[model samples]
Target: MEQWKDKVVVVTGGSAGFGKAIVDAFAAAGATVVSISRSPDEHGGNGERGNVFSVQADVTDDESVAAAVSQIIQQHERIDVWINNVGQSIRVAFEAATMEQYRQLMEINFYTAVRCSLAVLPHLEKSSGSIVQIGTLAARTGWKNIAPYVTSKHALSGFAHQLRIESPDNVHSLFVCPGPIRRDDAATRYKAQSNGLGDAASTPGAGVKISGLDPEWLARRIVTSIEKRQPELVVPAKARLLFSILQLSPRLGDWLLRKFAS
Candidate 1:
């Protein structure tokens, strides 16, 4: 679909993984991609085969996020899609996880998205732009050891749902919740299995061991959903079934998660 062609798109956490993939896909499809990340990527300015713009911003920092949004507006005049994709997690037992660690995760995963959404809401409303939130199956299924991550994702989904409820006539808010993908970090961590904790995402492919939808594939789905103006969608196809089953029986879903989430 050429709906994204020539459009202005902003992706947070654009330096790597799914966010980076989304930026690449949109740029390749002819959209002007503005990438927001904590640090400037080595490959940021090149745009390589497509149009890519990099904006260094820490989603946890309000001023930084605001400046990045301002820069995008100054350059693009309007934003056609504002995607909130920044997320961070620390795997730790509930008792072991310090309050500071919990706060850190919340700041990055929940508050960051909130700040970005608020910053771009006016722009998105003006352009009738689409707001896509990159969510996780963790939001649906809570894990025992990762309470902080679980809670943050839960909050993220809650925020998205609230936004959907209050969405303007022109603007659309979509949440793309995908299950765990084969990430190299997760795999390596799984291999190491110290204390039975799986995976360390110290590099690319760190999260590739688990079955996952290709980032590019997910991005295409996002684009298609935007064209059709879908409210929210689960990626990898299987997520739809899981999403339905979980929604139908939340307690059962939680039981299954607790059973298998080792």
Candidate 2:
């Protein structure tokens, strides 16, 4: 905890959900956390000028992201951590998904991270900081009826890997691959988008048999991983079996993916 005291941490899409949990966790660690949100006033901050500050920025737009990064640099001087946590998910079969949907998902889940990472890379280089990509188990493997999401996250996972390969030794990249996070709207958020794909298609994780992860606990684990400079982390740990099988035998991996479906 003392290790993070006063360090500048920036997280995108931190107004709510698991990203908000991350903001709270970093603040608890005594880091000066700047949470960038598309709408910062909505359930963002308490108006207390504490260790956490919320800034309004649309990460999808390069100019908006650039402006937000500049403002943070002017105010904080240096950024010790840049977390590309903005992500979106949807339910649609690859055959039914539109090019527009693919573009939108790619913009939100992939390019947002790329823009934010590029915006802060120089400052991070100066501070010898870390880049954290909040991804999911789907980033490692595929799930049904969410091909665009899986595709976008796969791109994000690759970008994180390339960052590790190219970044200097002082700069670290942490790619987090967690299981489905429990949310109140999990049952219905994508029901309308099911497109005759059935309830399993609408369900989070594409009805994968894995239990939902607690967001707060996941956030704490992420902070700890950042501290350890762990390159790639998969929650529930057991899920690593799928990635291993996929590498060793694609046939067995496909069978396991089908077997894991609820």
Candidate 3:
């Protein structure tokens, strides 16, 4: 945290949820946090600690993303860390999800990260900065519902891996994979509406009581990982083992997934 003092940090989709937590955490740690979101914060872009600067940008649009990055650079002159945290999801059966929905999910979840990463690459290269990509557990396995969301995350995971491989030694790319996260009120409402189709269309894991990690805790861990420059951080620790088991024993993995879905 001490290392982040005066650092310029940009977080996309930082107005709420994990993005908001990350923005607040970094701001509290003395970094200049710039939050890029379409909606403006109620506090007029200033965070609780008065270190967050809000910028309105549609990450899905290339020109908008480019302009946002340019504004950040023009103001801060350098970017120390860029967190690509914009994502969205809808719960529905794979067959029920339309191709249009899949494309929309990809644009919001995958393309935003791609556009932002490319937009900031030059500045990051100059600063030897870090790009932190927020991923989901769905990326590691095939889930019952939310196929489009899972597919988009899988694509993001692949992109991040390749980017890390080709990126300069000085520039670091890290991905954070977490399971079902505790949602905020707005997110809960959105999920409810998305699941309103019928009982048959209910979200997978609807009644399951799976404990979720706190956004603040996850944010702190992410900040610490960024400070340490770790390549990847998977929440709950057991997810890594599950990922391995899924790779090595497909039948067992399928059984486990079925149990989870049940």
lDDT of 1 by residue, 1-262 (tens): 3766668999988777778778877887778888887765544542433478877787888898889888888877989899999887655656777889788888888898899999999998989998988888677666555678778889999999999989787989998877664454554443432254444332222232336567787877777787788988775565566557778999776665454433
Enumerate clash totals for all models, in the order shown: 19, 0, 0
Model 3 residue pairs with clashes: none
Q: Where is model 1 more than 4 Å wrong at Cα?
A: 41-49, 189-210, 236-251, 258-262
Q: What is the lDDT of candidate 3?
A: 0.82
Q: lDDT by residue for model 2 over 112-183, one digit each (tens)? A: 999899989998999999999999999989888898999999999999999999977889899999998988
Better of 1 and 2 by lDDT: 2
Candidate 2 runs further than 4 Å off: 43-49
Tell me the deviation in Å of residue 93 in model 3: 0.9
- Compute the lDDT of residue 33 as modeled in candidate 3: 94
C-alpha lDDT score of every prediction, in listed order: 0.75, 0.88, 0.82
Q: Rank the candidates by TM-score, best first.
A: 2, 3, 1
Could you list the CA RMSD of all candidates, in the order they appear? 3.6, 1.6, 2.6
TM-score of each: 0.85, 0.96, 0.91
